[model samples]
Target: MTTHQLTEAQKKQWEEDGYLVIPSFFDKQETKEMLDEAKRLCDEFDVDGHPMTTFKTAADGEHVGDEYFLESGDKIRYFLEPTSLSPATPDTPSRLLVPPSQSINKIGHALAILNPVFRKHTLESDKIRSVAKSLGAQESPRVLQSMIICKQPRIGGVVPCHNDSTFLYTDPPSAIGAWVALEECTPENGCLSFLPGSHKLSRTATRFVRAPGGGTTFIDVPGVEPNEEKWDDMDGWREAPCSPGTLVLIHGSVMHRSPPNPSDKTRIIYTFHMIEGGKGVKYDEKNWLQPTEAMPFPVLF
Candidate 1:
């Protein structure tokens, strides 16, 4: 596979804005194949004995979890869009009935290890290593998680403002996300927005993990909460809408969010985060998602 490296100007922009947009990172053919693969996965997964437990967001906009949701941490599963369920009627038994055309929110967390197509694009590609080197990651970076975010038309849920390192955190916070657009993204279709220079402020404020009792929980960091005031200021933020094949590199500490889709178009994107796996950088064992013995995260050297 052909590899693309970051230019000096792009590296400078990343340093200043905590993000970099690489236009046409993938060709039209590649993007179309990826989108096709995503659609196939969403439509064909068999849930014979397993419960059809879809991911749901609470009223507070946090993810609601159960045993089924927690067990899917390292498995390929389909999560339904929050608004895809039909309301209960007098004849309907359950309130959450999957609509005729099922709206899937995402299919993720284990695609790189289980799916050959996704593995080729992620672990087998040299582009990830080249980008890591440009970001000054001396050691080989390891892929932590991979997910395809499907912002379905009209009913796509809003993702609240937050940094990625809070979820895929390592000691000293070396997480970075490579987000590839599989279709044209626009503000009307729930494209991502970023707070420039937010990474330089603080590494992380809180982390999301499985609680001792049950369900997912967000734990606060001891002495860090940078960008709270700046995050409140809306002027410094900007929307990053791009065409198909564009790749957006996100700094771990940068605050970013995407609004709900209000348009008829669907915004499909494949994203994954990488963390430095050097001797000194500690990947916390308590981070909720642990690597299985059969397939650990691939290292990109």
Candidate 2:
């Protein structure tokens, strides 16, 4: 699980850009094994919404907006859209969701991922934490939210742009989200597009709701411009593209969204969020349909 320790230069880049791409962050063998396990899960699970194999061609022969046509998937089943049973709600207090793969091998791939490398990549890494401290973070962060996104091809829908801070009711108003790319990502393949420094802007949207047609949309934070160019110019506003072994570390305030997987291949990615440990922030678990703990698992520090 060893990796090239974060460098001073990379740390500086993260502080300035708001995000950094760490290449080859996972050991090749480990990555391969994880991918193998994901494939196995796809086979065993009763995938419902759209099979990860359909694609819609564009008039220009480009794969741009095709992702908006595919359906979203629940690891337990596929979803044509967000349902009452789904926890993808914005008003919800605690939104963390874990994958079903955790029980596969007992000490299987899931545990390996939760092991040192992945956790340390964002939590304990001195370089990353140093950058965080410079940006005002105190203490190591907790892996408060985690989930696996199994993006099947043509399984498209728009997860509109919004700040994660809006959903997390906390003071000092901050958190960190890391999205790991499990497959090669491209715009046509439904890769994520961010509004650059949109995270620094004041809350443009206060509530989250689904668009009439089907896609999800958020109410904009007052005072922010709907202008596109402003966000497009942010230092870290770049569209991140990665191979199977890269990770995207993002601040909680950052505004981001991704469309459906339009390509025939599946774009599987895992996402995790962490808050400064001992922050005293509590999650209202009473609303949960299932008996979920405030902090479901121990922070892997």
Candidate 3:
């Protein structure tokens, strides 16, 4: 079912909790294909440190060759604001084939569900219809393709707490992100955490910075401290750890992120976005690059 067909109870839960985990969003076959496709793309895609231009470094004493030693906090900020930094440099490979915006295409039937299931049958799907109705944009459920987030064990990355909207650049603020876990995601494996009611915060608070490996971070504006006390008091502000095929829907403005995956296995997950297209929205060419243009994939409803 599409998000549009969500019941009142489901919608209420999302509105109150900022996110809801819908168990069994994908079957075993679909899950396997999605993981396989993501791995295939990731193999072709290279991962490098963020470039030096996007942010300023702190006065840390450690030095590694010509690179500056950035503090833990600065590293978070630096990667988040990669307006200038890049994954590759002059000494690296030449003639970059991947887009700076790391949207990759389907290698197999992996992402076929996103295009056909969500787009072609969106009007007929209950879930999509319910979500579209809630957003007050029933005619346009701007559901983007599903993306795979793979983090290797021990070397799993740290994604500091941030929002999802900053990267979309959507005005009037009505985008939603639905993440489906392909593997068991525990706190040890860097499960996502969210600040309850954080979505109620102004859209202005969400900031975008270029992230490592050519991704982007949707962070809170600098110097604006989050309500730690409120988060502590609210039961809703919690960690969401799920087994494979679990789906969690989150508002785009919610403050959220995943910590490092300290586990021994790789963590894989699929993330998709829904945009409401009534409020005079314009695409941000720099960020919205999809993989279909560079690579083609099959679509299956």
Candidate 4:
């Protein structure tokens, strides 16, 4: 393999497992910069007059699909952790049980575009460019969205089984996720788990898109569903735990999820998704997350 391209072994892993976990991909300095910046963002964010909405996944067939979430496609927005909310009383509705800083689930959707630090480290980095160019997943790859997931303490929430294509869709369904660990991820702290080789066997993954009436919802893409036998069997699932700087490149159709963090440590991660933005590729206007005039998708070399 050329210095600018991924190794032959890495490409092999991508074909076989549908994901590649590269140890220390981001290096110590970069990881420290990302982690420190994320912590600062969480610490300084003002919650005044803001709705303390918790981020939820459809692990239960429901999630927060409010206007705040929908409009945040081109902006950085805070989402609270589901397990951090205080119980609601008759008069008062549910609220954050702890400090807002500790309760945040993520700051998402446009970090790579809007945040200077993330933009510098992510889109502008030569390493990122080389990696993206190496994968060659899309004819013209466009970075769509980015986030810093604060899997906070014992209150971190579970992300249900799903695919990147389900969240960031394009015609011919091009979506690849670049995920980096900013802090150590372990089984106790909710490291990622993948249904290895599921991308090849599973047909079309579910699509999360704008509902016709209003808000957002999940609709199945027209294809055969995953085999129930494979879904039920936990023996084949691959648990991926990593040190602070590992990067995981995930294919669009890979079925993956993370369990809730029962440990006291936070498992922080930074991730962004890329999709096809070439002339013939179609990005639907009705997608729940839409690019604005100000922050439209930019093609990566």
Cα-based TM-score, every candidate? 0.90, 0.60, 0.60, 0.94
Error of 1 at 256 (Å): 0.5
**Candidate 2 overall lDDT versus native:** 0.48
Candidate with the larger lDDT of 3 and 4: 4
- Candidate 2 residues 1-301, lDDT tens each? 2224566787666665556777666556656755665566545643234322222222222221122221211012222222112343567532213232221111111221243444444455554454445444436555544445665555444455555555433344556766777788778777777665455553433433334454333454454455443443355545677888777777666766676655777677666665555656543322111112432423434
Give every collision pair in model 1.
none
At residue 41, what lDDT does model 3 achieve? 55
Give the lowest summed-lDDT range of ten residues in model 3: 71-80
Tens digits of per-residue lDDT, candidate 4, 1-301, equal 1124689889888989999998888779989999999999999878786787778786656878888898998889998887788777899978777898898999988999889889977778778888888876777788877999989988898888877777787777778999999999999999999988888876554678888888788787666464454453556888999999898999988889999998989998999988888888788876788988887887676
* Residue 153 C-alpha lDDT in model 4: 89
- Please give the clash total of every predicted structure, in order: 0, 12, 18, 0
Give Cα distance to truth, residue 199, candidate 2, Å: 2.4
57-100 in candidate 1: lDDT tens per residue?
A: 44363775677666555788777776776654799632334442
Candidate No. with top TM-score: 4
lDDT value, residue 101 of candidate 3 = 27
Q: Local distance difference test, per candidate? A: 0.78, 0.48, 0.52, 0.84
Window of ten residues with lowest summed lDDT in model 1: 93-102
Tell me the tens digit of each residue's lDDT in model 3 across 1-301.
3343566787777777677777776567656765665565555544355333222111221112112212221111111122212366679732323243232211111232433432333223455355446544224545553445655565455666556666555555556777778888899988988886777763544434444444444455455554444333455557888888677888877877777666777677766666665447644443322334433222111
RMSD of 2: 10.4
Question: Where does candidate 2 stray beyond 4 Å?
Answer: 1-4, 47-138, 204-237, 280-297
